[model samples]
Target: MTLSLNDLPLRDDLRGLTPYGAPQAPLPIALNVNENTHPIPDAVASDILDDIALAIRDVNRYPDREFTTLRESFAEYLGHGLTPEQIWAGNGSNEVLQHILQAFGGPGRTAFGFAPTYSMYPLIAQGTGARWIPGTRQPDYTITPEEAAEQVRTADPDVIILCTPNNPTGTPLGLDVVEAVYEAARGIVIVDEAYQEFAPHDAPSALTLLEGRPRLAVSRTMSKAFAFAGARVGYLAADPTFIDALRLVRLPYHLSTLTQAAAVAALRNSDVMLGMVEEIVEQRDRITATLEALGYTPHESWSNFVLFGGIADPRATWQQLFDRGVLVRDVGIPGHLRVSAGTEAETTAFLDALASIGSAS
Candidate 1:
């Protein structure tokens, strides 16, 4: 017999929940999800292929649960004097976050973040049965250290999520705010810097603050910059003790042999792998500048995506782009929409489409 979710004895809180994702319909120009628009450089692809072949030779054996080599390579990439013992790896940054909340947040525990930030932060808390509390950001999509501290003091969350160059908005928070949040809360503080590679050169990473702050964890991914999203590698830099705690929560051999090999190859050829970042940054700047010139309010973006306000109807705008063979994100923020920075040609197409829409409006 057919049944509704309520008939399946699902958790009451999860009964009405829709899964989290942006629309991904494989449009001609897919700027909806914040993904790398560039294909892997030929040389790098060749190196990765050879490494994958080597890794698959031993596929019959269980992969390394420790992910030791990947962790060491990541530690070197992070370069805040991090040691392999202090690093942890998971399928994606999302899984790394789940491990964190599982370790520190639970039924009675709470996790907090600033609003107009990463939507997944709250959803991750819900998945772990932890209460999610969102504090407000400024009108410009930034939160002050004072405001963040007060929110932490009030909520007393067991985990704090700081999304640097935060998703959707792309606002980079200063380390001051991170420090304040860490000091005001009693639990683990996670600074999600998934897009840090796209930020301005001067943008500081929370990894720099890891020396004395054992409770502070900085999570990053090879997806955006390294163009390794398919590799499924995300990691964190924290104290070795905290890394040990994640050992209890993560599944055994979570990082596959092929995944490990791919990540290692990417890290080994870091220069070639990250070569598109500067070019992508150029496209992002072009998008921001063109949006500003068109009389829309493009919030300052340090990530590879731009979120622009002044959209009278974001759903209509999204549909308009979709109709034109492009797909951008309608991030539920009224009067605004987000578009990822793709190839220069993709950027021009987006601009030309928006210019048309504006003209007709």
Candidate 2:
């Protein structure tokens, strides 16, 4: 008598939903997730190991409950005049986001984001017992000031999330749209800037808009640009009061000693860890250009991945690429697929494999 999930009691809201994750296959060239794909330079890896070694010596005691030193290091690294008092972190950006929802969202409250954005937003809302509302985006995936403001005013949600350089679509949101949404809404506005390091240097970040806005938060992660995805470090910058609110819901000593130590060491070598961004951006642009030449419509992207359309059979093409020892994402968009920008050699391998599959037309 095997007990299946259907036979066991489960939460009503979660009973029918599938878990969120990309497909995983063992392939020689994997560009499915937007990982940095570059190994940490040897010197930096050695430094991180040394720091982790030191942290383990204190294993007999609980780690810092506040993770004070790690917060300070993050403040210095972000430097839009941010301070330790304005910082909050968790196991990953997802957990940090979960803390936000726990503090401000619950039954009768609603969380909002544009449709076709990160899939986790809705799942996180559901898990927190909040309703999820998905707004619309332009056909090209960009949202305008008017559309955003109107939607926020109408939804009047408890928490609003805006994903710049949106995942799966690679669309970049404008700051003006963010401002409009913030003004029209009565709740918190979170800007998920997971790919900020890959954007142009001249671009202004939502951090510039944080000083006077207490309900605004700009979240970042070391996963993409720092090649620290495995380190599980994600943080956000916001008002001290907002940070205090999260503290109420978070578990004691949420970040372990080893995690804090590795993140701090990586921050210490920020220049070296970030040196790969320029190269990754180059490969992203290369992918976009080659995609166009190959007769696909590659959407404009400021991040380290390219999402191209014109695929006649997305799943088959994905499988063909998989069979050829390369892996890319079939992100559920009809006639389209997304591929992360990898190392120079890896990028060539992906592009060559894609070429061999022939044009989607």
Candidate 3:
């Protein structure tokens, strides 16, 4: 007997979606993606090779389904006493966010976050069949906890995501705001600190708020500060119960053996990573100053990149930079572009390029 093809309930929300793509090619200064342009130091590279050599025997077998050891090491790296049970590791924190949305959000549920934040939040929510809602942010791009809490009350969303030192803008939401959101949220409050290492004054981590708020999940990525973008390791820390739920939805052995080995090595020598972060912060300050000097006002950035308002049309400015062989991210926000802070040499090159472009314009 021939079976009919129309027998199932198919999700139509993701019908025409185009997957996310990272930048490709021979652009001179790649400050588009917020990647650390530095390579792993030679000593750290040697350690990673050694760790992989030792862990080779476990490759034939599946990775620990729970990733216990890696989770423990990651928690320690974060200076939090979180047990493995309270952690979830994924291929990247972006995947961790996806798993969260899939587990808690779907048809009839809502996932809310501020507009002009991470470009991926709404895309992920829609792909999971959740209603994606955009909330308002203050003029400085910071959102108050009270505003967030009120949105939660009205939207009754299944998930609320906040990006501190937020993407593209680099403005940080205050800790009191986070506490208020935690108190207000009946569902999950995800604080995505993808740029936490560069945040000013060691901004309060959501892990600190986890004791009282069971639904708070803080997602982090090694891709940024660790110079391990290719390693694809990201993690989520939360109350054990919420973490347990994450495990149920996560694919078994989702983090490959190579990824775990790289992550463990990276965490073991994280002090080296911190040094690079410090350098990037210094570069960011210099870039901000240069932009301000050029008569372009830049937002106070605590991340590895700076966001500024351009004197000309932002698209025109981006084209000018492109023509000058310095690639930056034109975030489509009016008169705004975000430039990733690179090395001292690269920063000098970018400034020179910007100056040439500004003079000609």
Candidate 4:
């Protein structure tokens, strides 16, 4: 006799909700997703093809579950003395976050972060049945140490997530503030540095804070800087013990042989990748300055995007831009929109579109 499955509770939290998916549109300047607008350089493309061909030979077997070589290469590129055992790889940083939630979050636990930051943190927490507590950021979109520490002490969350160079707002959390949170956190503190490549002056990475903080994990993604959004490679750097806990929850042979090879190839040519980053940063500054001149107050961004408000109505402004063949991200925050820095040509087109609209008005 089949047991009555209908009586089972559906986790109680995730019931009646549709899955999240990014909106699709015809690719017009395509600056909504914060992707690097530059295509892979031809020389780099050739190198990646060579590496992928070599990796194809190993396709018959499962990839090294440890992903030792890739992790070591990444550590070397980052100039950190990290071992393969101290790292974990996944399809994307999003998946890595899910693994963290599963390993460290559950009922009676809470995950804390600053609101108007990365949109994924709360979703991940809720998916795991953990309480999500969002602290408010300062008017400038920066978080204060005292505020974060107080939240940790009062809420006593089991996990804390900080996104340096935060999304949709493009503001970087000060290193001092991050260190303060690290000191005060009761459990795991994840520093998600998905946009680190665009940061000014090589801001201190959370990897430097990992020696004493066994509860810290720093997540990175190839999708942003390396322009491998299509490849879907992301990794975490943490203490070996923390990585082991992540290992327990991650699927076996999760990183495909192709992805491993692509990451290694991307890491090996980091100098080329950095050149592209320089270009993007230069373009970002130009865009920010132009937006300010247009009377749009954009946040000081260290990422490859600029976020601004005061468009009268953000949804209306977004609709206007879309009508002009430009697609931008209109975050639900009133009068706020985030636009990625694209190639010079794309930036010019976006500016031209906005100018045209302003002139028509």
lDDT of 2 by residue, 1-361 (tens): 9986788799888888888887877788989989889999999999999999999999788899889999999999999889999999998899999999999998889999998888899999999999999999888998899999999999999999999889878788889999999999899999999998988899789999998999999999999999998899999999999999999999998899999999999999999999999999999999999999999999999899999999999999998889999999988888999999999999999989989999757
What ranking of all candidate models by TM-score puts the best one first?
A: 2, 1, 4, 3
Clash pairs of candidate 4?
Answer: none
lDDT of 3 by residue, 29-116 (tens): 8888999998899999999999988788789998777777798898788766777778888888889998999899978899988877
**The best candidate in terms of lDDT:** 2
Worst 10 residues of 1 by lDDT: 352-361
Per-candidate TM equals 0.98, 0.99, 0.93, 0.94
**Mind giving the per-residue lDDT tens digits that candidate 1 earns over 231-296?**
778999999999989988888888999999999998999988788999999999999889888888
Segments of candidate 4 deviating more than 4 angstroms: 1-11, 359-361
Which of 1 and 4 is the better model by TM-score? Answer: 1
Model 3 residue pairs with clashes: none
Between prediction 3 and prediction 4, the one with superior TM-score is 4
Per-residue lDDT for 148-235 in model 4, tens only?
7887788778999999888878888877777888888778999999998889775887788888789999999988899988889888
